[model samples]
Target chain A: MKIEAMPAEKAARAGGRPGSEALQRRLAVAFAGALVVVTTLSLTVFETARRALASSRLVAHAHEVLQVMNGVEGTLVTAQSAVRGFVITGDEVYLRDRDSALLSLESGVQRLRDLTADNDSQRRRWQALRDRLDERVALLDRLVVIRQTEGAGRAREFLRSVYPPPPPAKTGRIRAITGEMAREEELQLAGRMREEELASAFAVASGVVLAVLFALMFTLGYLAIRRRVAQTFGLNAALLSRTEEAEAANRELEGFSYSVSHDLRSPLRAIDGFSRMLTEDYGERLDDEGRRRLAVVREGSQRMGRLIDDLLEFSRLGKKPLACSAIDMTALAGEVYRELRTADPEGSPAFDLAPLPKGWGDAAMLRQVLANLLSNALKYVRKDRAPRIEVRGWAEDGRNVYCVKDDGIGFDMAHYDKLFGVFQRLHSAEFPGTGVGLAIVQRIVTRHGGKVWAESKPDEGSSFYFSLPQAAMSGFTDPPAARGGRR
Target chain B: MNRSRNVLLVEDNPYDVELTLRAFEQNNIMNELVVVRDGKEALDYLFGAGAYAGRDLGDAPEVVLLDLKLPKIDGLEVLRRMRADERTRRQPVVVLTSSSEEKDVVSSYNLGANSFVRKPVDFTQFTEAAKQLGLYWLVLNEPPPGG
Candidate 1:
């Protein structure tokens, strides 16, 4: 079978999906901008509302000034009429009425002056009205005194000169002055009402604009959120269906392998068996070259068998479930080295298993990993020197990395891309293998959520390092009894 | 002693059956060997049905060497049918096949197969395996009383 030459790192890189971080950042910026707009809108509305309140207050002040001015005019008219009646009829009751009106006249003018204090023009008008009222009250008082002390004839002459002299000339003087003040107050009231109306209208317009802006922003945000949700769900559903299809494909491949194991082996067995039978049953009839050729045929069939087994074993690793626990790396390496030494006695390298950091993974799988690396080191012993292998590890930065350094015939670093590829070999014949050991090692380490790589120069010793995450390693530990007996 | 009892070999491939027969002849057992090509033929031979009808109702094979892959019915179904019948439930059957996959071995044992063995590719190992089966079943293992 032609296995693809894709390296593990490149395959892992190809499987990654693009992230939604940019979309998330865009949403955050949009929300911040909307918040700023809403704050500015609220501030504008508050300023309009404050202006409207001040305008209304000014209008109320104008109304008070108008009322005080009316009261002053009424007090002046009452005092003048009472004083005139007293002089004309010589009645003491009219004199009492003139005194009481004159008493209230002073306070009414003072109140009008206080109400118009905020407006300079209205204050000046109030002063003019107060002067008029003071003069009228003084005249009325003189008339009252003449009526009481001297006689009715002199009071009558004084009143005729002041109040009853003409039909509208004397009353029109104070009334015209007060009418000017009241008209001014009324003009100011109209102006303030207009200002209040403009402020409120501005406030209402700004409120409506804010509401429309908010609604537009809300609908936009809601659509954006809904679209994002739809996109996310669509991505999830596609991912789910793709995962199911991949699973089904994996099962189909598994069945294919199962049938291939059964079907292919029988043909190879027949070839080998018949070859052996030919040599054994017809040995005397064949020449020496013929027998050797038949022997080569047997050797070829056996090698093909081994290759098939290795291929099947490589595929089987992908199907096996992982059983993870804390591993004593030192003991595992030592045991794997011991087995290698016993299995192949002639290639016993000087083994040095230094203190290794503990790990977390399936025991049998990791044992296979160690065995593959160590046996690979044993296989590539250079012709010039005695074999020397060293194994050691350390824990750093949430990971435990182990390295197996071998004084073997290392290959060139230029072919590093094919180092962990299935059935890829840099050098053949010198090293006898199907080149699946490193692939299996990489698979096991990758399954444990780890990484494996080799560093070497041609003719220098090679070093293979594999690392496991330490934080995940701390969660599982083998029992004290099982630690010693575990395979 | 049931010295002349029959040995039934259920295998579909012509080449494998020829090789197994050659191995048995080399072992010199000289017992009557009954070879069936498929699972249906094997079941028919055991129960005296179809082609083997009215021949020998009282005769039963001492051992059945069954191969998993067959033409008409697979070996697992044959084992299940054998274990279901009272006449063949206690029959000694050894599952012999080219590939002994884990699932095949598990299901074979689960269906009450007496023994399971992988057929070696090397002819020497194949001959040794045949010798061991012929000696153990025909000479050593005690057959049931009635048959």
Candidate 2:
């Protein structure tokens, strides 16, 4: 049986799924961006609050200034009313009221000056208003003095003369200054109130935006985790079902092989046994052709028996549980060669065995593979000259590759497809084989998670190579046979 | 060699029975050999029941060469029945079959079979196995105390 060469599959590099990793990275970046936005918004909210505080203070200051201006206007009007009452009724209580009103007016103007001190324009207007208030209070006091000293008629005349309002110029100037100052404070108060409102709205908006961002981040993370879990479950379920199917198929195959081994061999035995009995007990009665036919029958039965045994061995190779061990390849090859040599003690093959590396595999299975390969090497040589065989091993690409090269009647590479098939014989007439040996070799190598292939040229030689994974070499003690040295 | 030794051969295949008888003749093992064709007949003969009811129970076979595959009942079931009965529990049974499967060998031993041998396809090998078996069981080894 010829085994066709199969290209080895390169091992896949170890890494997480590229798509999922990119998705995870993107999720991280998005989350980080969300946090940055939240942080920035939080700063915005805090700044708004600070601005609101400052604006609220400005509003309070504006209200205080307006209140102080109104106080000054109220004080001046009360002083004027008290002096008028004193001059008209000649009442002493009215005169005392005028004196107290003048004192209150003085203090009100002084307070207004202090409150408007931070504004240069307001301070100038306040100073002018203060001077006007002082002049108005002095004029009111003079009226009260006139009502007391010159008597009622003269006081009335004096008031009338001054009451023309000094052509409305000086008092107008005082009223205008106070009105302008009050207007300025009112404008500032309105501006500060608007700023407070805007700040409060910004604070609320930022809070809401930040809350939404947090919710979004949480939802995205939850979805990512949920999707990954669901994918894993789906994959696990598929793998579980596939494994069960494979196990069922394996069981069926084992049953078939068992029955084949038991039922088929019995008939073959009977045929061979009876044929031998016929020849032994009744050979004299048969003619030459008859005896030759009987011999043919025995030989046919024996060959069929051999075929059945080889078939059983091939099937059993698939089912046998491997007992793995560390193997010294050089010692193992020597052992197989010695055994093969013993089997054909009359024939000597020139063996060129190179230094072999240690390997990891089932010792018995490996022995079977080597024995078959070496036997093939010894079998297919020309009868005219001695057989030359080479054995070598090397480690490459995480595997140990061993090669058995023989100078024999090599097969055409075109027929390589028929190799390693059970019952496939390349040179059945020339080579005596059940055609299952290379098939058994293929089965054993595959079970070890390895591959087998060959390179050959007709009449030159054939080189058969098999490789075993390096990972299987560890965690095993060397076989006892290997330690016992060459037998 | 004991001339009075008796052997029971249980097999369903006629050709196999002939081949075995021929091998025994070739080996010159001349002890009296009784053949039963099936598991049921073998059970009946061993226990002296049915067609064997009139036979003396004390004249038990020294060894039973049991074949695994048979008609009516299988070898394992027959072995189970034999081991279960007090009358036949101590009788020596050697399983001789074509199957060399690990499960068959293990099951035969588990059912109290004394030995398991695969019937080699070669007649010469068969003759040798038969000779060894007869020399050991009927001639050399002592039977259990008569029931």
Candidate 3:
């Protein structure tokens, strides 16, 4: 059986989409929520501190008012005792004590006025207390003078006036005033105690609420971070699995390629060898028609050899690592053009070589790309007109832009999408290509992280452009002369 | 000078062996070509072991034509054993295989093979190659003296 070589398939596998956008959205929501929680917690803390400070101030004011009331009551009792002692003993010592008590009473009344500054009701009560104390003091002074001069009888009269065994109306009025003052003091103390209670309660509640809120915020923040880490781990695992699968597929393909090249070639060689032997041993006995048919078989086997060679070259490109370095665009283009000219020296084609920016790239691969483009341009030129080819380059937006323009049998814009695909051809077999040149160029460009495209119109002209990253330029230097010299 | 030289041909395929024998006849090598279908037979012929135990070890072939792929024992193992033995270390072993793989070529040279040649598919080319090789090894090239 005649063994026929099948061409290698060249379809690219599609890639999976990433979930970066969803992760970004979740991160943003988490950040905003954290900000709100922090703000609310801070405000609660501030209010709690303010209330604590206000309650302390109220406590201090209530204590001061209580001290003044105690001093006033003590002074009234001391003065009444001194006056009664003088009246009973008829002694100057008691009279002196009565005068000193009068001095203490006046000062106590002044202090009561100062301590009750915040309350109008307490102030009015203090004024009434002061008036009553002054009346008592005046009666005591008269009794003291009488005791010094008129003896017990006049002293007794003065004492009666000062002590006032009591007019019911006046006593009731004084008692009412004292009651009002006591009530006012009690009210002030009660108000201060209420504020303290409220402040304590508010502080405790705010502390509890803030603690819970902060804890919740912290927990949520931690959870968000953990989730993000988990998602990252998942993404990494998925990427790792994809990489492993691709590596496995690549290894399988390599094995298959080697087996095809080695095992398949052996049988093909036998077929070719045996067939040749038949023609050699029995040629004279055969007719011209038979010889022609045998020639067809030989030609078919040779075509199969060419197909195998092309397939091997295609797979080799995938496994081969690129050697990247700085490449002088102008020099590289000139070298390719020179080779094209030598291959078809008699064919008239005006060439325009422009000054080109240097770029980082693989020298051999770049040379291949340029050779393919120039040869294609030369092959497709209009039959009537002389071929014209132009090569130019420049830096734009931190990238190197290279273009090859030609006056040729340009293709329709509708078929532009098919140009870079493997085995996709617009021209007939007569043009003499395996329809793999452009596809190879695209693969090399993509490996370099660059983009390539073409613009053309039928029967007019075509221009191919490609862009490469500027950063790649620093490592690669152009070969002073093309390595494989002009063809 | 006219003494017929002994040649050992190690190959698996009968067709390839037939073609090689025809090539040798057409080229007038005038040598007693010894055929070994696999590496085991080749080893037996060289070492005088197994079925060839009664043969003289000193009467080794002038040249051993080795094929890389064989059924019982591979050609590389046979070549390795030949190079290791003092009695047959200097024996001329030529690699004649269908594969032009770089690894095979490199390995044959590394293992002390006297020469390496890929068998051409075309009958005419194969015959021409055999003629040149026969002249070079059997007629022109000198063999090492028996130990």
Q: Best TM-score goes to which candidate?
A: 2
In the range A324-369, model 1's lDDT, one tens digit per residue, is 7777889888888888888889954688889887887788999999
Candidate 2 chain A lowest-lDDT run of ten? A2-11
Q: What is the Å distance of residue A485 in model 3 from its true position?
A: 15
Q: Can you write out model 2's per-residue Cα lDDT over A1-487, one digit (the tens) per residue?
A: 1112211211122134446777788679768867887788778877887887788788778787778777777777777778778888988898678778778878888888788888999988877776777677777768777778889898788867876664245456677888898898988788778867877887788778877887787678778767777766765665556566667877887788778877888888888898888888898999999999988988787778888889988877877888877788898898899888987876677898998878777888998999999999999997878899999999999999999999998899999988889999999666888899999999999989999999999899899999999887766655554642343
- Proportion of native contacts in model 3? 0.21
CAPRI accuracy category, model 2: medium
Model 1 lDDT per residue over B11-118, tens place: 988888888888888999788888999999998988889999875745788889999999899999999999999888888899999776789999999999989988
- When candidate 2 is compared with the true two-chain complex, its DockQ is 0.60
lDDT of each: 0.82, 0.83, 0.75
Better of 2 and 3 by DockQ: 2
Which of the CAPRI classes, incorrect, acceptable, medium or high, describes model 1? acceptable
Which residues of candidate 1, in runs, are more than 4 Å off? A1-226, A382-386, A456-460, A477-487, B1-5, B25-32, B55-59, B128-147
lDDT at B1, model 3:
25
Best candidate, DockQ? 2
Model 3, A293-375: lDDT tens digits are 87777655655655665566666666678777666778888988888789788679999999888767778878878888888
Instruction: Return the lDDT, model 1, position A332.
Output: 85
